[model samples]
Target: MTDTAHALGASRTLWELIDRRATLTPDRPVLIQDDRRLTFGELRDGCERVAAGLYGMGVRPGTVVAWQLPTRIETVLLTGALARIGAVQSPVIPFYRDREVGFAVRESKAEFLAVPGEWRGFDHTAMAGRLGARGVFEAYDTLPADDPSVLPPPPAEGTSVRWIYWTSGTTSDPKGVLHTDRSLIAGGSCLAHALRLTPEDVGSIAFPFAHIGGADYLVMLLLYGFPAVLFEKFALPDALETYRKHGVTTAGGSTAFYSMFLAEQRRRPGEPVVPTLRLLAGGGAAKPPELYHAVVREMGVQLTHGYGMTEVPMITMGSPDDTAENLATTEGRPPEGMEIRIVDGEVRLRGEAVCQGYLDPDQTAAVFDTDGFLITGDLGHLTPSGHLVLTGRLKDVIIRKGENISAKEIEDLLHEHPGVGDVAVIGLPDADRGERVCAVIEQPPAAPPLTLAAVTAYLRGTGLATHKLPEQLERVEALPRNETLRKVLKYKLRERFGAGAGADGG
Candidate 1:
């Protein structure tokens, strides 16, 4: 472990780590957005003042305060202030609406709710009122401000649960995952150590700050005393200016991010996309090996992908020194202390980085096995070199003719097709076959239109089994993705085409 990781691992709370880093590098930049920059010292002082302001509003220790704000410096300050006050914070993604927001507010029993008011032409404050959210207030440009002397000392215990992160409710309502200061620190340390980042390295956070990754990334900055550029609204070309202006050395959100960067690099063939960019790293969705190769070969940057989820933010992360083949094929190796047990082909996790459990006791009880490992629904086996190779989700298996096939296996193969910009393989109900394989593709603008027969023939030439070949093909302009991390909403694909409505194959 790096010295920074060792010191941060010993921290009792997130606030403690922040304060320590601030003392070490009081003038070093910690957060940057366009022309604005917040140094480590400034962050600590700002958070204290915000904590005092919140305290004056009756936000004492253990208060359930929820905020649905964008990725901004003020949002980070507010979150830090909550940590200082020992408030149980529940951060909701800014894009979430009535169903998700209402459920989170009610489930967390939030005493106070913060919104960004009329951000992006939507009246979040009005919506919070409609949901009957208690203590609704705006926290966009301005936050509570007061004397820091009035606030109590920061929480000393890191084991107590103080964070409630909601999972992406694709199949059902989002589950409230419980996290503590120590757990989040552990997750961040794993990422920081595995990436082998130094204090001189500058980072970027393009994803939602409300996401669990926000905390995970922040913890790394605190540990290494490095700065990261924050993008309130992230899109290619427009956001590229900020990355270049800040000379971001390492940046990536997910496989979609890699694709977007690669697309931009293709537009300007000879020149580098972000000249300062030396590494691209992220993990949330399955990364196609072809994407990795394209980023390395075409974009001229080392791409290190990892495996993580709401349950455990950093399970495995690829290092820069790793072999190109292992880095592309595997999700990297688990760090020390993380126990990976393959139970019946399912990945089970037990470690300090793992979450305490869900807010729902019964749900938590059902997910953990008798041995106390969180029963991850993912299916994978560890490589001989200790790397974790994820096949697909247990629920993502497509059973056709009494044989199980991995959707990721087909999707990865399809991603190699030059005509395919993006692809998702789903199972649709069929009368004759229990389930038929459907490959929904998003073709590149320059590529010629594809047909069902053409896609199957390509797969067959690649040695894919006849039964595993996609029996149906549906072309779309773009695949449906969630706001954060841009993971393809496979459930949405299944819902749209499950009834054989869009099948174009024999």
Candidate 2:
């Protein structure tokens, strides 16, 4: 842990951290939107007032409040107010429709549902009502108002479960991942220490604030005393100006973000995409080693990827000062307290940063092993230097002719192909072979179409085994991705291509 993190040990809750930071750096900016800024002092005062207003509305400690708002300054304040009052907050992603929203609200048993009225041409208030949400109200430009004197004492403990974050639920209903102030603080501390950031560094939150990463990033800022630019809607060329305008020193959301920046830099060969950008760091999906080399070679910026999930916001993170090979090939190292146990090639975690469990008792019981380690479901191994190299998920293994083949091994090799903009390898059921390898690709615009023979040739040239070569190839304009983090939904691919057992491809 960094000295700052150790010194702030007295801050047991998120509200306490906010108060301490505000006291230490009252005038330092913590949040920045288009034309608005909120300093630490302003954040504390504003949130307290909002908390008082919520208190007036009978939102006391432990009250369940569900909010689905955009990434705006007000949303931050609302979340902070909930923290101040010790409310159990269930943050739903803004893009979720009735099915997801209804599931979250009902599962969390939220007493109040906060919406943005009609945002992005959708009536969230109406949807909340349709779901029979209690205390449905709009919290866009305005929030509740009352004097701060009515507010009770802030939360004193940090270990109590106070957050419920939903997963992407690609194949089934989203599961609510339970979290506490301490777990979030631990996750943030790992990120902050690994990145070696300072107060002088400016960051950017291009993803949704409702995502688990939002809290992870916010905790870093609170610890290091820095500010981040908020993007209501993040697009490549459009958001570039804001990044340049703010002199964003650190920016990245995931592997896709690195690809976008690299693409933008390619547009202007001689110029940097963001002159102030020095490092790109994020974690949610897998990172191709080629992508790391490409970002560093072309963008002239250090790219440090990490391993994390909704259950544990941060598990391992690459350090800025680590060896180049480690940064490129491994997911850095875990913090001092995080225990990584490799059981039968699967990575399991036991640490303070890890989430308490799922909202469903059955899920909680099933996910944790007897040793109290959360079964991560990811397959990986720890290097000699303690870095993690993920192979793939257990479910991602393809069984072919009594042999197990790793899909990620093929996907990583395919990522190097110039014709393949992005690719996903899956095993289609085959009566004789058990399963046949299939590759779904998204070709780059204006690039020559990719052929199955050409792909097989490239793999063969890479010295890949002939049996692992894709037997079929499917091309699409774009792959289906989850809303948050933009992770490709491979299950959808299986659904789309699993039926044809024996199909010829070019």
Candidate 3:
């Protein structure tokens, strides 16, 4: 399977990968959604027809098309059509509003924009009109279609930047991440190799399809010739029925997703969440070592977490054959083509999967070093055996009285407590201490209320250092998370509590 996937991965463009896969197993199913099953051959035909329609609508080879759509077969088909047209495509998360959508389209100089007419009662067409976006059109259940002969030739080269993904706008407006078809194919190839998936295996895309991971997952389907269930709007238990219905073999999106499944499993002890589920794997957020163990023990499945970002979707991924200890403690090893170098505790990466650069050339210049390695602001070290263990982000280091404290270290310890459903440790501004450790927690149902003193006592009992104790704690109803991956927006916590916003403790 690896050899075949590698060969298919060599295809110059995404369209080429699709064409190759279609030729190999034209009758095999590739995408399944509520009542709709699309085979590989049908996918090719649909993409070409959609491409013809888009071409008739003035979409040329280099035309910039920005789309904001949900996870649906039509969405994937539209993306394929754009690829077939050799258009520079920029996808926006469906949840993004006026500011983000407007910024992305304007910044990308989008020649056309696609949106669902009125999905989930939002009236996206109206929103696009309000933004004064150009070439606005609806592409939901019914897409514009035409004969394939009307379209031009598909893109031949894969190195040109044809895909623009957005960074999580946790801080401000997201920078448009530039990716070539080859880069995406490389990332997906790393994933397909590491997971050891076969044609018999089924996957699921529970997250937003507009995310960069969407392409990575799509490339895997193309390479391995497998089908994945698409969730337009995924919710627990409700979506579990589809997982079971499709007999999904591999499932996971991020750490938040794993926690959701674990919480659901706890509802029915000794029962599998998804009976067919064998492995849970994902990246995009920090996975606590405790979460890894819980999923393994209670759910009766192997959990393989990886390290990836928008810049490089699959830098390192945990293989199913890795030792339990490595799976729990490390982020797994980089593949043959990936090069990892740690300088001053920062993880630097140089690999085919890495994106070309950001839309802002200045930002790109700042991120890459003289050696061309993308300077990941993440702080970590590689083990002797080549396993990468991330400590925390460079911005996550909270210094108090000349001593540096890792927020991830404290959060990991706090996650072990039964009373804590979720927690985020932030460094709040403190005049006396320069920066003070503050822990914000979300309480679970039926759990005892946690106080700052009780939390500090628990940390001490865990053999945690005295100075690393959180000086302040805030119990919130829920942690603020980005819509895409549910990654905790720590900056929001700092903004909320740093100004002495009535938090508990010193």
Candidate 4:
């Protein structure tokens, strides 16, 4: 972090950080969308007005406010305004339907809700009404505004929990992860310093603003005094124009995002997808080594992957200065304040960047160790150079006839095939073996269909063990992915193929 950023990092709360940045870089652009550009001064002044508007609506300090809005300029203002008033925010992914949204709202005890009205033909207000949500209001194009005189002073401390971010909850109802302003600042600072960004660097937020990475990215911009283009509805080729127009120096949401850009580049061979884009960086899901090599070779951009989650938005990030071998094979080193521990081959973390805990006290107690380290159920070990190499999650282990198999180990090998665009290896229940291995594939359109024999043959050629070989194969038009980060939903695949979605091939 720069000297100015380090000084800004000492702010006691998110609102204080915003105010400090606004004071220093008042006229500098902070957010850009279509034709709308918000400067730091405008952001500070605008949010204070909105803060008064929210206070006028009976929102007080510590009031739980739930918002399900897309990635837009208005969403940031609402989040900032809430911070200015010291409200506890519960941001739900916009793609979530009634079930997950209702669960988050009730669990957070949200006293109010902010929606986008009828965004994308879905009436969020009506859904909130159906869910019996209180204090529902629309905040799309226009926001409530009032004089700043009506609002209370901004938050005085950063240690108190003020954010409630949800897990993806692809398998079960999501868990509400608790975070404070200081924790978020640390995560964002880790990202900003690791990437070595400057004020001249234009970034892009192509993912949903409801996710924890949203806050992390926002903090990066605030710290480095840079601007980022917002994509409310991001898609390939269509969104490429905006990226080029803004001269985005850095772009990416996750490994899925890198694949999307690569696919686009292949569509128009010998042409740059986004000429100004030089670095593709993100971390939410595991990045395949083949995917990294392909992206660096095809897109002609540096790809820096990382290891992060809702609990700790920025654990370790690959730096642009690191070697290509390290960038391709391992998640980069953690910063000074962040600590990574490998306990019995499982990665455990204890740091300020880590979340305070979960909403439920029992869940919190179960996740943290006796020494205050957050027990990440992921299996991995630190490299000699201090990089993180994740093997798989504890739940991702496939036990067949009392023998343990790592799904990631098999997935990594299969990802090397020329025909395989993406693959998800899952374990399914079987009458014979305790659990059978299944490989679900997403292939290119022009590529020939891969048979189970061909896949097993390829795996065998790679020297995969017989016990770890896949027993079944399923082909899909595309892999099921969540809205944010585009992480492949392995549980959904297990649910689909576990019910005999495809014939067994052994």
lDDT per model, in order?
0.87, 0.86, 0.87, 0.87
Residue range 1-506, candidate 2, lDDT tens digits? 45775676447999999899899899999999998999999999999999998888889899999999999989999999999999999998887777668989999999999999998887889888888999888888899978999888899899999999987322235678999999998998889989999899999998889888889988898999999999999888999999999889999877667877888998998799999999999876566678888889999999999988878889999998999899988988998899999999999999999999999999899889999999977899999999999876755666453234668778888999999999988877653344678999999899998778889999878656565789888988999999999988988998998888334462
Clashing pairs in 2: 452-506
Which model is ahead, 2 or 4, in terms of TM-score? Answer: 4
Provide the TM-score for each candidate, comma-separated. 0.81, 0.80, 0.81, 0.81
In candidate 2, which residue ranges exceed 4 Å CA deviation? 168-171, 395-506
Q: Which stretches of candidate 3 lie over 4 Å from their true place?
A: 169-171, 395-506
lDDT tens digits by residue: candidate 1, 149-266 = 8988799899999999987322335679999999999999899989988889999999889988899999999988899999999888888888888899999877667878888999
Candidate 1 clashing pairs, residues 3+ apart or interchain: none
Better of 1 and 2 by lDDT: 1
lDDT of 4 by residue, 1-506 (tens): 79998888777889999999999999999999999999999999999999999999999999999999999999999999999999999998886667668989999999999999998877889989999999999998888899999887788999999999986322234678999999999999999989999999999999889988999999999998999999999888899999999999999887668878888999988788999888999887667677888888988889998888888999999999999889999999998889898999999999999999999898899889999999888899898999889876765566553234667777888989988999998877663343678999989889999999899999877645565679899989999999999999988887887865386455
Tens digit of lDDT per residue, candidate 3, span 1-506? 47778899899999999999999999999999998999999999999999999999999988999999999999999999999999999998886667668888999999899999898867889989988999999998888899999876788899999999876322335578999999999999888889988999899998889888899899999999999999998888889999999999999887767877888999999988899999898886666678889999999988998988888989999999999999988999998899999999999999999999999999899889999999988899999999999987755566453234567778888999999999998877664454678999999987888989999999878656566788988999999999999999988998888787354768
The 10 consecutive residues of candidate 2 with the worst lDDT sum are: 395-404
lDDT of 4: 0.87
